[model samples]
Target: MSAALDQPAAVRLSLADALRSARETRALLVGPGVLGETGRLFREQFPGRRAVVVADPETRTVAADAVAAALAAAGIGTEPMYLFPGAGLYAEFGYVTRLEASLCRHDAIPVAVGSGTINDLAKLAAHRTGREGYLCVATAASMDGYTAFGASITHEGAKQTFNCPAPRAVVADLDVIRRAPDWLTAAGYADLSAKLTAGADWILADALGAEPIEPRAWAIVQGGLRAALADPAGARAGRIEAIGPLVEGLMLGGFAMQWTKSSRPASGAEHQFSHLWDMEHHVHGGEAPSHGFKVGVATLAVTRFYEAVLACDFERLDVAAAVAAWPAPETEEAAVRRMFAGTDFIATAVTETRAKHPAPAELSAQLERLRRDWPALRRRLQAQLLPAAEIERRLALAGAPTAPEAIGIPPARLRSAFRRAYHIRRRFTVLDLAVRTGQLERLLDAAFGAAPASTAP
Candidate 1:
């Protein structure tokens, strides 16, 4: 099958429809120069509200300043909040704590004025401070966290994603967004592409009885994906025509996760790969890859793994023998520690693995179910997943990285990461499925070109 390279952008996403789906996100103001009306919207929507406008040093000029000025023009009180300027700023525990303090001190609603990090810090701080939601004025079409219902924060030196509320509203000014770095726009497209594999993973879990797919949540994201990503070249060129759809697609991803109260609709193994790198922090010469960039590459990797699995010969399996060979809980735990040794986030890996590792009997049952349903499961995965090469083609067209090497993840680390990626989350993923089928090492060998014994579960 050929890629849908020339399809027109889909129109399934609308601000009103998306807001209705997410219930928590009251409004989404998107268009040219929407930031100029942020104060009026804030006052009208959140009557008598004073805002603590949040931004990092970089966005303080273009985004935060406009929000503050607009609020001032509308005679609404504003206390601007700025993170200390540095490359070190991230959505981690320390930043969340500091932002929460600012919210408490100012006694104002958080009006975020940046992309991923700033938005995550603001939303999580609002939740920690007991607010149901906050607002965001997007400076760039970077990641899909603007209206997402959680925060990826590093706590206890581990990348821990905590449940939080979605943004009360999102304001994206197309004029300002068009001026953002082309890479950020391309990253937005790259991020939304993960939904293809994410939905496939959800379908696999649902098919095998590990988890049920949420249809409403799935529709919110999966429906318009094709149209949203119809023009990778346009996105690469930073054209508003293409970038606009990308933003709409990303917002829908957030709403899907919000409706389900889980990341299953927008994350799976691809996200685990990105999160693993965040915790490890050794890529790109110790400069962490952008969430979207890493996910794009990992999405391709996992998609390839899925394609092979979907086509594998299930008749070759000896279910009873495989069950007998399943790794012990203690062995998996030891492996987790060994794989993540010297890493700050090893605790998270250990915690999730211990909590999620199935007992031998349980594994046998799941494997039995999987074997019974292999044909149906295979059909569902094949239907849901796009070709890995199509994704690679799209990312390359958008000037995004399509491999581990492109993101500074050496071949050895890629192998190690794939071996342990499933341990980072207490949720089922393709990695878990592959391990269950006793084909994980084979799949990894295909991706990494070696049957490393260390990858065995």
Candidate 2:
């Protein structure tokens, strides 16, 4: 692929260049008709091991027969770990247990044959069993959690990210993706857009000495996100041509975490919002929406937040006082229950420690340092961040939800999500900044509107 094709080309090929420079992978291939050769790939990659194909029941019915025929023709044994129907099913503990049992029963090496949840289950199971895992990506929608070094799954009914390795190689058969629901493809594009704001948040963290910048990996996320958002059809049909870059970009996003040993590069305010929504789904007894769908809405909110910041005279930003009045224990606990739905003792302890010592003064000094370095920081972001307009435009083209209302979330929920979201994860993100500064309510009001505006798309 062209270097510029990996990220937003208008922003320069910096992200693409970075990814090319940092990648340590077997390979990633996306083509219109690559599914038929699955058996060959398994044989070449693992000469003697049995191949276990893990997928959801719907996908199994749609694609399993073809895969099985190929395996049988190649004289390779195939095992299917059919998941429950629908999103978030792959992460449920029962599903994990069943898959584990299947793997143990067959002594199988897994090949996840579906997108999202199926991939996560195989990766996590492989990690636990120390078996090699591979993925045949079924869609080009959004770029995240694909080639990453972890599995974001639900354990005991709560979301958690567990350590794992990227697939041996990611094979995206674009033909399969074209047949997926348009919403899935759009969700993928939205997930890729989050990279713009996510990259900015990482830059801020690095500037504050909280995180380190890996230019090469950052470049992957930057380029991949930019490129995916730039394609007009990426917002629409989620075509094969678009899939190549989107898949490449998302794979690189996950790989960047491998390089950084952290998720700082691809997570920011948008992610927190998605996490809040994910928990709410679990709490209210509903299927969790696709990660990209929630993230698309959150990305727009962050973009609007940054835009507002750009318009403001932040010179008068009350950094110290903002941090001083940070949440107390009762408030923190309440926020956690509301946003995260539940909290374990470790999270509670961390909240209490931070609550007792609101480091606003220390953080305030850091902001001054950031202000002094804003010029360089701005340059870095300019090279990577997507403008809010472009992000919304791309999402609209993909026919994905670009606002809270599109996802059945109430306008009040958006505001509440912002206030309580920081407690969902101990990580410091844009939401933390908004809450500390007491600007969250205003920010949400601006992004989603005063009323839910049920018209949000």
Candidate 3:
């Protein structure tokens, strides 16, 4: 099939049009051999601006040097590149502070020359230093944060999204990305695959009147998801043909987030699992799992939970009984406290849980709406999600870990996460659905054997 024909209609717009539609980003060049145009692209976006390249030692060898050379060739003045430690670097606030210090010393725009961590650091630092926006030189097809607004940074033992604009311009060269380590490419593919569960969560939220779906933002992320994820094997083999769609899908997710000014467009319940892990300081083999790896496993778990939900006969739901059984505000807060005991996230969890906790009347209304809308909502969710086994198959083909154990999460711990994750985010998802209907413990028992804790009121 022709490339244009293979792409979803929503993303067939020219690059210029895509950039113009973005809220903050203005330019994007994604193709093989686009790295050399970095200087020209930055110049077009911000004229007469000096550049400062930010990279880790590893990325410096991979693409930063070439980026600096290109800027010099274009006669764009540059400050000395700031390099962070390559080893054990993560998206922590300390790195952002250090980068901010470096940026504060000069008025030059930053050119972030790495993947997720590098981009987030430069993004927040640039925003803090009062720069309009920075440029991004992507070295891998790792995550969708390349053009997404807000940096996911760990601060005060919680994973927080610090508000920040995406890069003014982004240049992603497929050659460099295709050459990235197999795990990195696999991680990106898995992250992109998460849109399946994310979309289903959005559909569920919309059905329950929790959060209405945004059609434009939806199209931006979901239009081309299947096509982007069609060839996991090709992505694993590092073929540009496969890498191209993968990177494009990841970028489109960011654009969707930028348009909505929220991560809701790109993240959902799957991300909640990842966030919970981050907050808990989950590490396997003395290393934290990549965001994509955690989400990949969470996607599989959420998909199975959706299957269980789909099998239920919602037509006979006892709305009045469910509403009467709902926990009061204080009862829910106490549960949140117990769930997050001995953690810094207890206060935050209590706050978020309260935000979504509904009164008896409100719960009744929502349950009525759910019972009224479930037939169609189920169809929408079924259409949005693939089978859990199929998701695992694709993730395995793409080289991502398909099981929680592979990423150092015990099966028992994962079951606990299903409930704890709900308290950490006010976002309505399948988790909330299970909780409200008193099906959470049953579903958890079915999915991961039996656990001692009661998850639903």
Model 3 stretches with alpha carbons more than 4 Å out: 1-18, 156-158, 452-457
In candidate 2, stretches whose alpha carbon ends up further than 4 angstroms from where it belongs are 1-25, 72-75, 79-90, 134-143, 232-235, 282-285, 316-361, 375-383, 435-457
Model 3 poorest 10 in a row by lDDT: 1-10
**Alpha-carbon deviation at 347 in model 1, angstroms:** 4.3
Q: Of 2 and 3, which scores higher on TM-score?
A: 3
Q: Which candidate leads in TM-score?
A: 3
User: Candidate 1 on 1-457: residue-level lDDT in tens?
Assistant: 0122112122244557666878578788888878899988888777887888888778887778878889899988877565545578877788888877777776688888888888888888888998656788988888898888778777876666788888888899988887788788778878988888887887777766788877667667877888777889887777888888888889888888778877788988888888878777645865667888998988888888887787776645677887887788888788888878887778888999888777878888888778776776676667677788788899889878987898898766777677678888888888888787777877776655775465444
Candidate scoring better on TM-score of 1 and 3: 3
What does candidate 2's lDDT look like per residue over 307-343, in tens digits?
A: 6544444456666666676666566555455543454
lDDT, candidates in the order shown: 0.79, 0.65, 0.87
- What's the distance in Å from true for residue 227, model 2? 1.9
Model 1 per-residue lDDT at 252:
84
Residue 388 miss distance in model 3 (angstroms): 0.6
